[model samples]
Target chain A: MQTVSIDVGDDGTLSAVLRGELDFTQAARIVAAMEAAIDDCRPDSVRVDLAEVTFLDSSGIGALVRAMKAADQVNASFVVERPTLVVFDQLNTAGLVDVFGLRRA
Target chain B: MIPETDSGYLQRLAELEARVDQARLSPEILSERAAGLLAGRIGCRIDEAHAHLRLLAGQQNTSVASVAATVIGALEIRRSTSLRQVRHSVEEALRATDQEPDQPVRVSAPDASYSWLDVVQQMLNALPGKHIVVVPVRGDDGRITDYECVAVSPGMRDLSGRTGPQLIGMAISTAYPDIVGGPVWRAWADSLTDGHPRSVEPFTYVHIDNGDASEHLLTVRVRPVGPGLLNSWVMHDEQTRLAERIDQTERLGNLGYGEWDLITDTTVWSDGLYRIYERDPADGPLPRAESEALGLPEDEPLRRQAAEEFGRGETIDLTTRALINGKVKHLRAVIDTVRDAEGRPRKVYGIIQDVTARETSRRKLAEVERQLHEHQQDLAAEHRLAAQLQHIVLPIPETPVDLPGLRAAVRYLPAEQASRIGGDWFHAALAGDGSVVLAVGDVAGHGVQAAATMAQLRHTMAALTMTTTSQPAELLAHLNRLLLALGVSTAPATAVIVRWEPATHACTWSQAGHPPPLHARAGVAVELPRPAGPLLGGLAHAEYGTNSLDLAAGDILLLYTDGLVEHRERTLSEGTAPVADLMSRVTAERRDYPLDVLLAGLQRANPDDDTCLLAVRRTDCGNGHD
Candidate 1:
């Protein structure tokens, strides 16, 4: 389901738009795409957009954490944006909202 | 048109006349003349007359030319004026030809001996298999020098590719000099000399082509016919190879063949047939009645159909079951009959194929399919039972109930699919300390196990609230510890628990990996800030904290499981936005019995998970000291 699409901004920020059900099935693919984008762009900042994500299970949460870690390893600032209420609730339940820098946009 | 008086022309005429006289005595010319004369006398075709002469020679076991000579001699005697004399002379000629081995009988018609070769050639032309007639050419010392081929079967060809008329007059010693002293040549000479049949055992005959030699194993049989020997050659390896091929095919195909001669009442079964029936070859073929009795009773109709088709002179190809040695086997029989000239069955031939392996596997696959269907049915039944148990364990109240300082209404929505009944549940009741205890919990997973865990957790919370302190944080901690102590079989769960004190107008709540409750007031709704607490059964020493919020009359608080705001097609916030907006609108409307209305208005975002919702509203009737 078109798991991730990446765009590099002029300010050295890499924005990756994630789509479809972000469960165990798409978790590995999402992480790999994010890592590849981070390695290729070496951006100053990274933003993962969960605006189109329809579902998030525990595995999806793990993938987001892994992506954030990948960004950290590259000395980049990572932010998660535009999570639906259900996804936000899930992040909050896992106590990852603050850790992922989840914010409304 | 030379002048008749020319000496050269006269000498040419005398030479031609002598040549004609010599040709008349030749065997071919003599046989032709005799056949012509016989045809004219009998008023029949010359070919029929020649055939008749050959047939008579065969009956008498003599040469056609000898028979023709006897006929000519009788006719010449008849020309001398007496039919009785002709008959006597014919009888005498036959007797002398039979008795005299070395004597000259009737001037020893030496040329007449070879006249039948053409008739023999005609016979060979009409034959089906490989055959050739070769006449012995005598040397000056009277010993057989060599044999010259006079007739060849139409289908017979030498290694040189010469066949039929091309092989005529070819000396065997020149064409196949390798066999001049071989077993076949010796057999031919011996058969000619003794006028008896002889056969040579299989021997290798090698032919050289362009200095490359190829070897063939052949058998030769010769029978003396007139002044020649009729030789039949067989490729010894081909016959043996053909029989082996048939045997191998039968074995590999799991098939057997049987033939029954109706006229003789004799039955013959191939070796494969004996193997198929698992009978010793020494036992002979099974009797027809016994073999028929082996057919399973269930296949009687198929047998009847086959019999009917057979009676109509139709070939029967049928598959039926047989019980042999107590094991059922599938047999496919293809039966046909050899019919007589009048269309009556003279012989019956049948090929029986053992197809038991194929049939057995087919039946097994069908059985497996039936079993899979029944397994799915059992799973469906289990789902129904699990759903029923879920309803009985966590029954939702139809109307809101009055808690210490609030009106609480609970609604339970099952998953859209019947099999997805889950562990979502809610509890809203008064504790022993005059405080109201409320809780909404969701056990991970579905089916009966989830329902059972939900029941256990609900009962444990109820018991804890009645006997222990009415504190949200303490109660959550206790529930978490209880989940951990219940062992790995108990799935991890999320729950939000709250204790409401009517005297203080204080609502203290805590959650374990659960969403904070939504608080709605005058035209606004917001999710309460959640305290630091991990989900139940996550750690050995997990701590929970409480969040307290002062409530006034007409304030509505909604607590629900993730199913209410979880969907596969959208993010969590998207799913919850509408619910939050609805709560704000409901509070703004200031409708009476807003708790009931809010619960009724809410819809689950994900139909694949069960949703449990608890809505409570602060009422003016409660003994609030705010």
Candidate 2:
């Protein structure tokens, strides 16, 4: 599955929709793609949607942290939304529930 | 047919007698004249005609002078026919002369047949070695005195570099005085006397040229042909040189050749074949049955297939395994046959090549690949076992339990991926001081190493709560120092610890890079503000601050590791908002088991990280009795 699909919103917010297993295998790719999209578009805000993400490991968590750091470097606010219950649980376990701006779908 | 009475007839007869004397003096001249006439009649070269005359004289066992007379006579008798028919008539006359021993034109004189000598010389020139033909010279008593060289092969160079016609008609005794009664001379004499063949044993011949004598080992074979003995000599060194070349070629190609003759019931193997089979040449070629026995039993089918192809008259090329000297070797054999008119094999020939090195390396590569695949499988199995061990060490309680001042429930969720089992752990117990101590922690990363670190942290926490103070801030500070002391090998971990006193309903909590615990009162829930503290193992001498909150009756406090709320696509606050809302709604319901319901309502967010949840609710009854 495609690791992350990036779309530029009308409001200039870059939304990266991550899908499938987002473990160590896809984490690096997801982080690189998100970073590139943020660097290229220089969006005002970055929104990462985890609605389609079936799995996320610690490495995946690290990837999200890196992406957020990328957006912060560009002065763009990073927001994460539309997380499945299991995915939300993982975010919560990593103590990133509030840090990533996760919202239940 | 001339008139005897004519005065010129006497002079003509005298001239004819002189002409006969000249012919006797030079038999070669008479033979050359006859060869020239035959060449003109046959439209061939003079040498070809000369060779033909020599062949005729040798076959007829007669003298060249007599054969020349016969040829001249035949041509004269056919002079009346057309010139084109002259060749045909001459052939017919020769054939008639052959069949009729008493033919009028036939000659049986024992004179020198120079034409026959020329034919033998031509054959010797085509042959590889040195050769010479000599006729015996008889004395008055009819005993052989010496031998005269009539012809010599072109390669028969003496010490002085003389050969062929230069040495012809030279007596052996005059040319090589030492050879008068040598082994070769004896062989020549023996062959001439018995009209049979004889061979001299190898002997050293020393040639003196310009006072420099060089010795050569040579063997000579003498065979009588008509009145002359044909002597063929083999130089030992020359034979060895040719044999050495064959040996080098076979060794370089790792090949050997063998031949089997059915008619002779014998098998011949080249020197290379003996080396390939690791057998001594003195043992001769391996017997058919013994050689077949050397083939590996597993290759019997291949042999059968080859035999079937051979039966169909097809050249059989097959590679099969052979066990030689207790080691297996790959042998590629290409076999064919010499067939007779009936299409049956009269002889079999084959070449065998050793291909063991190539085959062995191919097998070794395949084996290495198989070993690599198996190693990957073993690694996967090890991951599974490590994950299983983590769960065994920290078994979760099936139901909530009543602690010192509140009822608490804990849930431990392992990662969905077996190999991703993280170090998420929880500890809740009543301390010796009677305060309820609760803690939740998650180590970074997953797999066996993370589980080991998690066990160490949890055990240390349990021991500290029992022996040391249960102050939340002090406990986190101690844990941080412990992680720092564990060195760089231990991944940083986040944890939140809480101590609640039932006497005052005062709750104090401290965290190390962990999320703030949720507090719910009268159906309203909010995240408690956290103090500054770095994750454990991040920095040495790091400090943790504690926050105190007074809980009223029916207040719920929830503490969880990040796996319960953290996700790749969401913020911690965003993920926790829903859980806080759920806690408020569930608390408002006034359920008898709010902690159980709240713990059950919360789901782990990430499949790759484990979660630990510890929920505690203050009882409305005094003394914290449920």
Candidate 3:
């Protein structure tokens, strides 16, 4: 599985691109990367670019929920962008699409 | 005047007297001879001839004695007139005698006192060696008035065999009852009156043995000679052979005939019927009720119906199963009624046959059909289980929701085939840093294999999400490489990734051969401008591209797979309009509802896709915090 990548813009906003699948088998790795990106950049808010993530199952949705809770604790704005239909369906089924702010592509 | 016996007259008278002398015959002998002659000529009896002679004499106003005497005179006169003809007839009768006694001779008569019998008998005697004895007789009762002995130079008996009157007055029945009660009697009795003379029909008569254990058969016939009298003859032999032929026909064909008298409740079965039922002839003469007991238990009702229909005067042919000697068999029975002159059933007749083989085969055929039906149902149930397992393994999401900066949502609609659950999926995630990564992809194909592939890809994506925060384009390229590593080179996937920063209001998104997402912001909805790339798992080094969008405060981002925008018969752009309209509503309504409500509302509005929507508002700290 591919690891997560975060690119911080000059304006101090962070965009984290998630790769490969997001499910129970790799949720821990994605979560750890998320924390590291938040710490390294310490940006004002976070945006996750999922436009390249190929697949998502229920465990992937659960991992995203955990990330959302973590962002809330830090008072940092958290958002999701360009989710594949697969990722959105998982969020849709979990009833958390709006919570992650999945951008359309 | 004295009648002169002239010498010429007297000599003529003398010659006439001598002529009378030469013709002189015993009136009794002549009468007997005449009777014999008439009996043969007219096929009547001797006594009947005597009565006829008397009646003819009375009608002529002459003495019976004179009539008798004139019979020979008249015969002589006839002989003289047709000597050649007489000789021819006499010779023919003589030749007939040489031919055989059984060979009959016919003689014609001239209405005279002495009939053709006299001529026939004369002809019989004239053939040198033949003799038929005749005794002179006279009867006062007109039967036999007189008897005397007379000698002719060429004497012969009138018929062959036993002679004389010793066998007279014998009752015919003492010999042949068949002759007494049948046609002979009618012929003989009719001869006693002024009836036409006839010969009795020939029939065999049986003479009982002295011990009464055996009998002899004879063919006897009688003919009326004259009024009230007849001559009869009997021949023996040829009747045993005829009776044997009738018995042979009865045995073949296993044929039996029977009749039941309804009123008397008496049943009669033929010999064949008893044999078929394996019953002794003496045992049966049973009633219809008893005969019914011969059928098996199951066949009793059918037997009863047959009997009832016969009682109702109907002809019924019924088949039923029976058991004989502990083995079941099928029997076809026919019962018919014999009605009296009144249109009511008087007797019933029945016949039976066997048909077990046909019935057995039919039952076996039905059993096979039932088994085949059950086997088909079993196969159908197995298919249903397969479909159910596919659904549980890869489920479709029903609603949309929000994550964070990226306005992302997805839809996973199962395919329409009731037996198939398709492989379409969408994923949305908020990583640990308040950053959101979302993806929607369609695994190649449908059903169980597709679902299993989806599970693998989905877990792989989540794992990578935490490992690195790569750009969306690089993320897809990496996933493609990972798929190739996992031996899924044949399974392709299309996905889009969107990452958003709430504070900067910027969204970076990439597409890997997935449908572009539609963005609704500032009251307008359009598919976001984005770079395109090949689907994952297609090539070893397939690349991807990303584009950035500045998302304003209440922007709604909708992400989905081709299933939402592509139908086989329609263009993808046709499907985009609806998603766009719903996106516009969500963006417009974002300020009035919470993130969850807004997501739910957008999903409800776009129920066609396995829709996933993520709506996030840019929150300001001051007003809400106070």
lDDT by residue (tens digit), candidate 3, B134-157: 222435665532222111114322
Candidate 3 chain B weakest lDDT stretch, 10 residues = B144-153
Candidates' C-alpha lDDT: 0.77, 0.76, 0.55
Tell me, by TM-score, which candidate is best. 1
lDDT of 2 at B351: 93
lDDT of 1: 0.77
Question: For candidate 2, what is the lDDT?
Answer: 0.76
Q: Which stretches of candidate 1 lie over 4 Å from their true place?
A: A1-105, B1-201, B220-234, B261-275, B278-312, B323-326, B339-346, B397-405, B409-411, B462-470, B474-487, B537-542, B567-607, B620-626
For model 1, residues B1-626, the per-residue Cα lDDT tens digits are 12446565455345323322111255566567778766544333577678878887797887777677666654444344367754664665466456664452221122554335544654565456899888888999999889898888988877778887788888988888788888887888778767889887788998876677989898888888766788899987778898899899999999999998665667999988898888999999999889999988888898887777776667889999877888888999999876432234556899999999999899999999999999899779878888888778887789778766788889998988876778888988888788888899887667787788888889888888889877988887888788877764455678899888887877899998787899888868888988988677654566788889877788888999988987776666677789999988978886454576678889998777789999888888763221
- Looking at candidate 3, what is the lDDT of residue B613? 36
CAPRI docking class of candidate 1:
incorrect
Pick the DockQ winner: 1
DockQ rank order: 1, 2, 3
Worst 10 residues of 2 chain B by lDDT: B16-25
The alpha-carbon deviation from the true structure for residue B528 of candidate 2, after best TM-score superposition, in angstroms, is 2.1
lDDT of 3 at B241: 62
